[model samples]
Target: MEILHHDVRAHNVMLGINCIVQLTNFETARPQSGGKSWPLKDKDEILRWTAPEKDSSETRYTSECDVFSFGVLLWEIVSQTRPFDKIKNGREVFKKKILIGERPNINMHMKDGHQISVASDNYFKIMTEAWSQEANHRPSMSSICERLRNIFHTNINEDEIEYTENPSKENDITALDPLTQTTTSENILTSNENNVKSKEEILLEKARQYHDAKDYSNAWSIYNNLLESDKGNAEVKFMVGSYLVHGPPYCQNNDIDKAENYLREAADDGYAKAQYLYYQLLFNKAGKYLKLAANQNYTEALYDHGYHLYKGTFERRDPAKGAESLIAAHYQLHNNALGKLNELEKRYAKEKKLKKE
Candidate 1:
């Protein structure tokens, strides 16, 4: 019944036809319950997966502690790297960081036009909640297992696998030059013989080429022309919205109103990025937009919400609140912003000390 022990890392995991399990070194396995104190003489060994409060005489080990360890294990699997590897003698350092409310990050990549994380954000979020500082806040192992099962059930689609096996030819054909006519092969060969360019094709090609060259102005211009000609092209509208909102140089002007307008258009077309950006602008002004973005459970907007709470730039400043936001952002790849926030924390602490003087 023992699924894993303390010494186990992700490499020990074995996936069978129906069951996934792990084998661990029992020498490192401390009793999960009814332990008077950690029997290990060296604090370092116990420190590896122990929570910050584990050393306190008042604290006792429990299954909930195992849940914390499970969170670390999950982090290892997703990152394909050791937890807390960034800190030297990282085991203890990681323990301290987690005690102070640090959370492991989820690695992500753009795949098939969708952002995919090494582990789903929902899974990490559940694990994080289950490993909260207060013992009562932690979920029972059975509950954790149920939540994880639901996450996999809802997020993992067999249809995705099937679709990946046979990708749509439409996207592939977009790369083809319209001037070249071919029925079977998608290749578009260079031919001096062709002179005419279809308006739609010309706009698409111009946008693609400009994007490839990182020339947003020309691309924006071409897209604007296309939009004027065919105002109903949802895809073109989405492109213009995205370019106007996020495009470099010109778009960097931070024209929130224009950004909001274009982003709204794209969001209406169901573009997740546009929805996320629009939510940020709205949330930045007032809390009204939080419901819209939060409802979708958009990871980016969640990170922003947490970050705004942490920065307290436009709101109230609370380190604990900011730390919580940073922790949530960590799961969503927004943790990079925490470095500046941490510096601000140190400055605030120093100022408080000076005031006491």
Candidate 2:
């Protein structure tokens, strides 16, 4: 039955009498078919907490994958912070970084300036093993249980901590196969004292993780906290405004008017993304904001602004300025701008040769 509980996260767990934990949620489960690969449906939000192998299309997943996820669980127990909390695109970046052997922040295990350590280095070591890249290298579920028992049962400041048998019940964590150096979104929510990281830095990181998870409501909550602390932050303001513009999944409602209010504020602060977004919201009527963004070397803005410069549609016709901006955009990975630059350069060369001839 434990094997059947495939999606083991905070949400799926249930508590019975005497605070016993029970794993629920078999949505991703399949019959014991030799731990082979299955067609992953749509990408799940759980990817924030999922194993790298499970995130892969190449490898077949085994229970070892669950061990990897358990590592994230341990992280949650320690940090109470979301995995990749500073990254807005969690899974995409997680895949790129984790697949390349990068793991989540491990600062929670030790404290230089933040609150005292919740879990010791020994526990951190065990977690790193769980999230090891090689699935076979991870400890079996039994070993994980045994080790946790040793830590809990031993006199390691039990006064500061409380342990529960079943993780499914209430706030108590059930230790099945905890291993990993980093925590993920679906793990237990842990909170620790201040560390070397500033409040805004910490909050921003968590907000990124929540945003990446598509848990927009929670992300917004974090955003609001930051906004209250620093009302003049352009990037944060832009994100909130952008959320309003995009609507649904990011925001509950698409309030363009409110979106403009925030976005304009960010744009006024000279934030390149905000300036471009404002230009877009105004039906491309405002070339100045677009120009402002392009001047800041914003890739999309450079391309569009260059296009307008060359075509004289919205801005004045200035081939020299257009070509210069297009050239810069070309190097910034704007394909259309590169193409336009190439065409213009070729035309210039041909015309020069013709004049000489």
State each model's CA lDDT, in order.
0.60, 0.71
Candidate 2, residue 121: how far the Cα is off, in Å? 2.3
lDDT: worst 10-residue window of model 2: 187-196
Please give the distance, in angstroms, between residue 259's alpha carbon in candidate 1 and its true position after superposition: 53
The residue-level lDDT of candidate 1 at 309 comes to 62
Model 2 earns a TM-score of: 0.39
Q: What is the C-alpha lDDT profile of model 1 across 1-357, one tens digit per residue?
A: 433254434644677654646454465465554334335544454454555556565766566666777666766666677666666564556456767877655544235678655447677777577657776787776677656654553344433331112334576644465654463233222231143344555566757787688866556656666777666666666667666655476343445566577678878888776677778767666754753574465656655555666556546866676566555656666656467457757877898899999
Clashes per candidate (backbone, < 3 Å): 1, 13
The RMSD of every model to the true structure, in order and in angstroms, is 24.8, 23.2
**Candidate 1: where is the Cα deviation over 4 Å?**
1-12, 16-19, 30-48, 91-96, 106-119, 159-357
lDDT of 2 by residue, 1-357 (tens): 345334545655678985667767666776555554344453454666677776546756567877887787778777876677677665775677677777778875555666533346657878889989888889987688656644442323423333333235344343332552235223444432221345566566767887898878667766756777768889889988998898887866888888899999999999999999998889554787889899899999998888778767675778788888898898998878888777766876787799999
Misplaced by over 4 Å in model 2 are: 1-5, 33-42, 113-119, 156-357
